[model samples]
Target chain A: MNITKVLDAKGLACPMPIVKTKKAINEIESGQILEIHATDKGAKNDLTAWANSGGHELIKHEEENDVFKFWIKKG
Target chain B: MTDKKKTTIVLFSGDYDKAMAAYIIANGAAAYDHEVTIFHTFWGLNALRKDENIPVEKGFMEKMFAKMMPRGADKMGLSNMNFAGFGPKMIKDVMKKHNAIPLPQLIEMAQEQDVKLVACTMTMDLLGLKQEELIDNIEYAGVAAYLADAEDGNVNLFI
Candidate 1:
């Protein structure tokens, strides 16, 4: 899938990745996929809850080495 | 779904880590479209104090109180391992190394997200903190106001 924006929240701690992702997702158009690159270990669960609560769809997520990547489609 | 989701926190600790935790939760709740309210009382009010000495008229006791208390997040001490105010710096350095947003920035983000920042009126009086001493963009209310906000809140936390 073609991603509209790639938000780098790597090297950040708990809540920072989600916070930055939330801000970055708003800069894109609806239906666009926002890819998040985060290093925080808890981003996996935090982003899941964040995407769900914000009414956004978590299209897919995967871990590449030490980094966790997520693609969210804004609702 | 029709009613607004509420997240209320009663912040009573002046510790840096505790304040950070409160801001983290507030920012997260606000991000998810929740109406967040942070009722800062007692030592927690220290997190909102201005660093600079504002020109405000006060009596001797008030002036003494103002000077005695730590002003702002940068000046606050940790709850443990203080070692005469060195612990905060160590933790702050760790936070910086991990590329985390500091407490002050978190507070700014919370405010920008429309989280209700409130100061306890009774605490301000007890601490001798004047209205002019706190940061901008905050509400001053007593316990009743906090109770009203927390009564129906989905997440009510005390830290």
Candidate 2:
């Protein structure tokens, strides 16, 4: 899948990761995909809930080397 | 009417940590496109206060209160482990080390996100807090206004 933008939120705590993700998603047009890399454990659930609540779709997410990566399609 | 989800929080504590929690949730909800409101009442009004002295005229009791309460969110004490006001300092230092967003910036972010920040009029009167002493661009209202926003709210919390 083609990625429109990438947000590096590694080492950030709760709310910042999601906060940065929201801001990043708004920069792209609807249907575009946003890639986010974060280290906060809570970002998994938080980003999922955030994407759902904002009408966006968390198409895929994966954890590698203690970094969580998420691909979200903006709605 | 728009079908936006709503989150309303009644900020009733003067503690720094509690206020931080309230703002974190508020900002997160706002980021999720939820209409958010934080109603500042009782000691919670301190979070909205201006840091500098405003030099407002007041009665004796009001003056006493003004002197006793922390001037703003930055000066607020913690609800737990507040060892003679040293806990806030420790927590702030730790937060800085962790790259955590501080309380003042969180409040600013909320305002920028258009989160409706309302100061309870009744509590403001009781605390002798004048609008001039609070930050700009915030609404002033009582419990009825809070209820109006909270009645249909998807998440309603009293913090």
Candidate 3:
């Protein structure tokens, strides 16, 4: 079973959150899930674009308490 | 498989607008899955500084003119373009308000995306800049370094 890891990127700006998330996802095996929490409005688009471009799958994304959440699966 | 494309941007303009334009292009390229690098030399280094505290113009005339124009980095006033008098200042103010990435953050992102950053040793030597003067995490290299990266890619832009 693959573990779901959480990445908190709140209060972080563009590129930081994305950069960290990319690093985290890189360490995960295929089908493993990494959840990213961020505040930048650009992250939704940025992460989605990154995932698609890099062959990762975006499983879920949401916003709560002004934080944007994304669940991405490593390819 | 389609060959992954990359780009190299040589930033020579010290004007705020030009720097901002380079950032926009860099960001776009990154979003599109292209590896991007930005080389700051001469005046271009000012835009990357973290201590920049220039104010965002709020006066009526400045506001009016800003609204009627491209505003910010998009309006850099290169000499050939005279009507673009307020380009530099406008770019600075917009960058300030938008919290545009500081040089440090920009370097961090470029590294994260595997974008190579090369500080022009020739220019640095000419400007009397020491390695300590630059932000941490930047690779100090000469034109040969930039050429190495540029040669491997198809996109080469001199901003």
Which candidate number would show the highest lDDT if scored against the true structure? 2
What are the candidates' C-alpha RMSDs?
1.7, 1.0, 9.9
- Predicted model with the maximum TM-score: 2
Location of the lowest summed lDDT over 10 successive residues in candidate 3 chain B: B66-75
* Candidate 2 lDDT by residue in tens digits, B1-159: 789999999999999999999999999998888999999999999999999999898999999999999999999999999999999999999999988889999999999899999999998989999999999999999989999999999999999
For residues A1-75, write the lDDT of model 2, one tens digit per residue: 999999999999978898889889889999999999999988999999888878899999999999999999999
Please say which candidate is ahead in TM-score: 1 or 2.
Answer: 2
Better of 1 and 3 by DockQ: 1
lDDT of 3 by residue, B1-159 (tens): 347777889988865445545765676566556777778776555434334223453566534533443222333354333354754455445556755564334545555666656677777555444455455566777777777768876678998
Give the range where candidate 2 chain B is weakest over 10 consecutive residues by summed lDDT.
B25-34
Give the candidate number with the greatest DockQ. 2
Every candidate's lDDT: 0.90, 0.94, 0.66
Interface RMSD for candidates 1 onward, in order: 1.5, 1.1, 3.8
Model 1: what TM-score? Answer: 0.93
* TM-score per candidate: 0.93, 0.97, 0.58
Query: On a 0 to 100 scale, what is the lDDT of residue B5 in model 1?
Result: 95
lDDT of 3 at B149: 69
Docking class of 2: high
Model 3, C-alpha of A54: deviation from truth (Å):
0.3
Tell me the spans in candidate 2 whose CA falls farther than 4 Å from its real position. Answer: none
